[model samples]
Each structure stands twice: as structure tokens, then as C-alpha cells.
Target: MKRAWKVSELARAEIRHGCSSNPRSLTHFLFTLKKSANHGSVRDLNVDADTHSSSSSSFDSSALFSNISRLFTAKSPTTLSETLTEDLAQEVAQLRDALARNLHDSDEVVRVLEENCGPLLRRFAGGSAIVHLLKQLDSRPSLALEGINELISVRWLLGSSFSFYQPKDFNYACKVLNWRRKQEDCEFPMTEEEYAKGIALAGKVEKVGLAIELFSEAANKQLRTTSTYNALMTAYMFNGYAHKCESLFWALKRDPNCSPTIATYNILILVFGRLLLLDHMKLTFKEIENLNLSPNLSTYNALITGYIRAWMWDDMERTFQLMKEGPAKPSTSTYLLMLRGFAHSGNLEKMEQMYELVKDYMTQKHNPLIRTMICAYCKSSGKERIKKIEELMRHIPEEDYRPWLNVLLIRVYAEEDWIEAMEKSIDEAFERKTTVQAIGVMRSITTTYFRSKAVDRLATFIKRAESAGWRICRSLYHCKMILYASEKRLEEMESVLNEMENSNLSQSKRTLWILYKSYLSCGQRNRAAQVIGLMCKHGYEIPMTVLPS
Candidate 1:
């Protein structure tokens, strides 16, 4: 009778014999390892002679363990604990390979690895591997942070000295949550920096409500610092709550613990600029000086941006002169903003001058600058537009040249109504998998095609965009339905709805309204009534004017 082999031995045997190539087989072995690791011992693994005979090519369990033990042959005599550690280390390397391969069930594999492999991880996995695992869980930041807490728990239970000292590891933790440990476990306190990073992460993921909750919690905990307040205010300002940002700024001023920084004033200026509160923006700039805070590059840029937004050419130029004289030198962003302002102001002379200045400061990585230059020329007249665009095109890096050229050509061709040229440019962008995020420009092109009743062209363009995974705006579908309704092509009209549904686009009040209007305009009162029913089903309040008798 064959002696009973250990679970780890069987796992190594299977992996060594091609089971690792099968994702399910790999997941099973990992699961087994996790179970055994958690139980503090490998279960006795047995294999029958018949099973072994069925796969004559397979290595026996003993042979696999023998190969692994040879790795430690040159070292001192190993104890059972050292042997277990070696086995756990090998499991970690396998986990890394499994993740790196990105199997179909890799996400599920990641969840299992995090939830079940804590002991093995604490024994063998280093900080970098933990960080990699966290990033692999990037789609779920909450879960990523929980993995860290799990490792911490395992460390405490094992009485191991595992610590996260790397900046990247700590920063990622902060981004997800303001985590703290008990007083006895080398406590990490709730801090303003932690709150700031957490809030920024929330904002980045568009979880503004969560950001607010974090800020409120910070206030309740009396962890309100200048950086924390600044971060929250920025989230508010960028998410179209500029008024809330202004109110927060005043509250920050009143709070004795939170002294406003230059960043705070910079955010305030931007808020005022966006709100068109030019007087308030200027007062804030003046207040910065009164507070004896030396204006930084960001301060001047914000002020200039405010001037540019309000179309105050004289003031923008004056501020630019001041920025040039002050300690804060202009950055590439300053010149790019100036270029846009000048182009819109129709001061091509000044635009060209700024373009030269921009080129001197800009690098190949400044693809946005190149796009802006092309857009600026598009707003101008004459062949010089093409000449300048081509000139700027030469400076774009080889890697970025194609995509940038596609966007630039789209803009130029769209402006000139070169339909074939525009379509070709768009096709190239999609083919290269660099679908342009120029939704507004695409809307304009689609609207042009729709208005002209170019149904074939419009359908082709929409199909191409959808195939390339670009989100088709709802308005485009509605407009198509309207066009089909006008033409009395009821079949195509309803097909638009089907397309929207198939794409997982939810029906909205506007969608129902469009359908109701379409059916009613087509003299199909019964279909119109069905749409009103859909509206009711969707919980949209029907307008009295659209109600059927």
C-alpha cells in the first residue's frame, strides 16, 4: 500500500504535471492550500495505485516533494516549520503567476486569494506582493483596503512583526480609508492626511456623497486640518457645487483649528471664476497678499484663468505681465491657456506668439497642448490653419502621433464639413483602439448627418462607434427616432429603442417623452397609449398635455 501523502505534496504533484495550466485546477490547489494553511496543518492526502496508473505520465507525489526539497539541500538542516515556510513561499509564487496570467476567473481567484490566503501571505508574501494584489482589486477599493486589514489581523494573531513601511503601500491604504488600529497594536491615529486621501479617492470615483460623509466624520472626530478642508472644498468645486465650496471656505475661516493655505485660496479663486464672481476672485487674490502669503505659480495661473474665462483680455494680459515679473514663473499650462484665450479673442498674432512660447516649454508628452493648437487653428481662417496644424503635428511623438493626428483631422474636417475625411479620421481612431472622447464633436457630426436626413451615413457612423465600445449619447437615439417618426418609418423608430435597451441603457423620462411624442405625432394613438403606460411603469409622472383622453 502507498503511504499517505500530504495535501501540499499532492498539490505540487498536480501543478508539476500540467494541472497549473488549467485555471480550475490551479484554483482548486490554491483553495486547498488556503484551507490547510488556516487549519495549521495539511490534511493527509491519499492516492490509489489505479489513479496513478491511469496517468502514467504524471509524477508521483514523492518525486515532486523531492524536487522542492532539493532547493534547500545546500542550506543547514531544515525543521518542519522551515519546510512549511518553503511550501508556503512556493504557493505565493504560484499565486503571483496565476494573477499575472489574468485567467478568465482571475477576479474570483483574487477574492479567494485575499480572503483565504492570509496566513500563507503573512508567512511568505512581502509588501510589494500585497500592493500588487491590492491594485489587482482596483475596481473595488473597499475590498482592497479590507485585504490590508485582514493581513493586519493575521499579523496580530500570528504575533508576527509584519509592518507596512513603504510609502506606496501606506498611501494606497489612506486612499481607501482612514484606518486605525487599537491602542496596543501600534496604533495609527485618524489623521487629516488620511481623510484627505480618502476624500480624494471618493471624489475620483464619483462617490461625492461618500466624500461628504468622510468630511463630516472628520469634523466630528476633530481631525479637521487645512489639507482636509482644502481637499473637501476641491471635491465640491469640481462636482458642480461651487456655491458649497464658497460656503465651506467661509466655515474654514471661522474654524480656529483650520487655517487656510495657498491651496485653499487657489480653490476659492477657481470657484469664484467658475461662478463668474470676478470681483470675489480678485478680492481673494488681494487677500492672499494681505495674509503675507507669497503667491505661487498656481495662484497666478488661477487668476489668469479667471480673467481668461471672463474674456477680460486687458486684465488677462496685465495679470500675465505681473506673473512674468513675480517670483512665480509661467508654466506650460499658463501659455496653453493664453493660446486658447488669444485664439478665441481673434488675436491670431498673439496666439502665434504664445504658440512659439508654448513650443519652447512643451515636450512630446504635451499631446493636449498639440490638440489645443490644432483646435485654435481650426477656429481661424485661411490655408495658414492647415500649415500651422501640420507644423505642430511634426512635434508630436511617434507613439502619440497617430491618435493626435486622428483627433486633429476630425476637428479640421468636421469644421470644413468634409464628411468623407471626418469619417475616415474617426474610423482610424476606432481601428487603433484609441476612440476619441470628443463626445461634443461627435454629437455635432451626428447631428449634422441627422439634420441632412443622411440615414445610411448616420447608421454606419453609429454602428462603427458602438462596435468600438464608444457610448452613443441618448440624444442621438432620440433624434433618430424623431427622424424616423417624421418619415413614418415606425419599424426603424422602434428598433432605436431596442438598440438602446440591448446596450443596457436605462429608459428615462426623456426617453418616454420622446416615444410618446413620436407615436402621437405619427397618429398612432394606440402605440402612444402603450408608451404612456411604459412611462407609468417607469414611474414617470405624465404631463397633463400628453395624457390620453
Candidate 2:
């Protein structure tokens, strides 16, 4: 009788008052309804076919709510709040399920609604729903590939503005530029112009990979009277090609034009250090000492990260201590690598302490990602100890805060089920024009498109990226050519090869093989001969082939 009276009373509120406009009043009324429904001895109500049908029909819901309401009311008042919380949670869960079902079955409805949502829904779609929607359309064949192309094109143009960088921004900027460029042209070859741009970027960033390309392009063409072999050897070593580093080091020693530098020894030490081939590391260190080439800060960090990887924590600490006493002091990367290692090892205490120690420097250094990363970790663990971290960051001055903080804040609030919090952050961010960061924010989308063999989208992105000014031409070239081959587009590959030849962006031995396969795959023997002719026109040697009679 008590449960029946409570249900009728709650139904009476919904039928008359429904949910109110005022938040507090609405919360109370909703809470009352939840309590009334949940506190009811529901198992008995569900067991009775007539009562169950009558209540579910009244609520315009399924038997699920009826059954759960029974469990909540059967519990005591101390458990009442907990039980009511679970029952209320069901409202949100059902909404999510309904949204998903609508997206699955009502494409036209979602399409029309999402377009009007402006950028927020676009980000949500690109970030979450886009890939799933593509997968669903896979069996539709007519729509699947085109749908992905549309999704990626929108992604390619998604950002608001690309801005100037602080010192800490370079790493992230490079990652974004790299990701964006690859998205547009995973198989686009770096034009000689693009390679030149990369060389300029090397001067700015001191990225070892770009340095290797500069010397490789110079040496492969035998362009200068000056020796490039030593530079290539140094570059190969630094890039962690152990055998190539060793071979090139020996090759340079024999060549009169090139000689060893202290930087060379550091590279050699790093090459061996990374393998944690303790014997090789020691040998290189001993050799460097003999040659009067002192190990630098980076050399030590390399050894430390390597030791950490090998679970030689003692050696890692020893290396750290040695850095303190030696010519080199530890940098943030040295600490970040250690922190990541500790994190992987599941040492939360050490991770926390290291994070706190790095906090001030990371801020001064303008490394906003560390804070966002910490927030992610905290959220994953469901720890409210550092609740609303993104909100707290807003108190800092413009000098202290990064422009990307809004993006981070919205993402966190969305993931936390703090719907009210998410709405506020998102509205603020949109008003502030945060949609720009979502553009190519995910490199995985580009990777997915590449894997799926989408060339036009890749080409479109590369063109956009060039205008935007990324510096990873070699990476773009490597991927773009692969995309061509994947689609069995030989003429396109041939055209790129011709462009590469003209610009002097020499293809590696592996790249040449890919080109050859592209030619054969397209059944273009004559075009293949033309490629050989084109190569010979540039004085590149071609094996003479006898015509089969």
C-alpha cells in the first residue's frame, strides 16, 4: 500500500509538474520521483504482471526501471542515497543508449541536427563518431569510402589558427605539423623545395632526423666539394641506426675528406647506450675518453632512458648522479623520460613526486601538456583529490596560461560525466574559438586513412599543410609514395619520381623498389622504360636490358 501510494504520487508529479525549470526545484522533484520509485518494494511489483505492465506503461519506460526501483526501496535509508544515485544514473545511461540508436538508425536526422551544432558536434563526430560511422557504412560500399573522405576533409580544415611557439611548444608543434602533413599526403614525396624547407627547419629545431636528410641528400648527389660522409656518419649514429652508425663511422674514418668530432663520439655512445648493450656503451665511452670527447647531457640521458628500459634502475640512478657531478646537468627531458618509465613501472608515489618537482619548471618552460597528462591520469584513477584541475588553471594570468587550455578543459569535463561542467567549458571554448585545435589534433585519423589507401584526402591535406608551413617533407614523401603504390597508381608515382629527380630529393634503395612495384602493378612497362630513360637523362646509371626476341 505504501509503495503503491508513492508511485501514484510520483506519477502525479510527472503528469502535472513534470521536471521544473529551476535547478534546485527540478533536482528535488526528480529526486523525489526517483526515491518514490526506487524505495517501493519493486520485486513484488515486478512479480505481479498487471502492476508491472501498469507502472511501465505509466512511466513510458521498460520493465528495467520497475525492477531496479524494487531493489532500491528494499534497502535501508543509509543505503537510500546510494540506491537513488544508481536509479538516477539509469536516466543518463538510457539517454546515451537512445542517442546511439538514433545515430545508427536515423542517419538523415543526425546529419541535419549535427550540422547545426556548429563545431562542437563536429569535434565530437571527428573525435568519436566519425570513425564508427565510417565502419558502419563499410558494407554500404557506395557510401563508406566517400563518407571517410568527407570526414577527413572536414578534419583537415578544422583548426582555427596556427600560432607562434614558445620553446616548449616546438615538440608539440612538430608533432602536429607532422601529423597534419601526413594526413593530407601520407605518400606524398618531399619536393626538393620541401627538403630545403626541412633543412631550414633543422636549423631551427636541431632535429637529428632532418640533419641526416640534409647530409644524405647532399652526399647521394655528391653535391659539394666539402665532405658530407662524416656528417652522415654522425647523423646515422644519432638517429640510432647501430649497424649503420658503426659501418658509417668506419667508412668515414677511412675517407680522407671526413674526420671525427666530439659530437660523433656522443652519437656513437648513444647508439650503443640505447641498446643497453652495456658492453658496447662502455666500449664507446672508453673510446670517447681516449679521443678526449666528453659525454654530454644528452649522452647521459640516452644511457639513463636505455637503462630504465632494461629495468636497470640502479644504473639509471647512477647515470643520473653522474650527470649531476659531471659536465652536464639534468634537463627536463631527462626527468620526463624517467617519469614515464616510473609511470610504466606503476610507481605512483615516484610519479607524483616527479610531477610536482617538474611542475614549476614545466610551467615556466610553457609545457602545458604535463598538467593535462596529470589530469588524465587522475581522472583515469577516479581520484577527486585533484578535482577540477582545468578549472583551477584559469586563475593563472595570460602570461602563465596556454591558449590550448580551453581545449584540454572541455575534453576533461566531457569525459568526467560532469555534464553541467562540460557544457560551461564547451560554451566558453567555442565563444573563445577553441575549434581550431581540433583540426588534425589526432594523427591516428591520418594513419587510419593511409592504412585504408585514401590518396585524394592525403593529397589535399599535404597541400593544406604546405600552405600552413610544416617541415617534415621527408616523412610526407615516404608516406605519399606508399599511398600511391597501395592504390596501384603508377603514373602518379612516376610523376612524383620525376619531381623528386628534378628537385634532387634522392629516393633511398627501399623507395626505388616501391616505385618499381608500382610500375609493374599498373601494367605500364613502357612507362617503366620512360622512368629509366628519365633517370639516365639525369646521368643515373641503369642496367642495360636486352630485348627478348
**How do the residues 189-300 of candidate 1 rate in per-residue lDDT, one tens digit apiece?**
3333345545555544445565677677667866555556666776676567788888988997887654565667777886687566899999999998898876766677
Q: Which regions of candidate 1 fall more than 4 Å away from where they truly are?
A: 1-186, 360-368, 381-383, 393-549
Q: lDDT of all predictions, in order shown?
A: 0.56, 0.42
TM-score of candidate 1 relative to the true fold: 0.45
Instruction: Report the CA-based lDDT of candidate 2 relative to the real structure.
Output: 0.42
lDDT of 2 by residue, 1-549 (tens): 456445534442342221111111111101001112222311111111221112111221122222222211111112223323443344334433443344323343335324432332222211112212211221121211112222233333222331222223122113222322333232222222222223323323434554455555544643211123323443343344568868867765564543544444545654565455777876777786786656665467556645654667677678888888987776555565455445445466666666665544443222223443443354354456336364335445544433355544545554454545544654564445444334332233345445556667656655544444332244455567778877776567657665556445687655555665567667777765665655656666555561212
What local lDDT does model 1 show for residue 55? 12
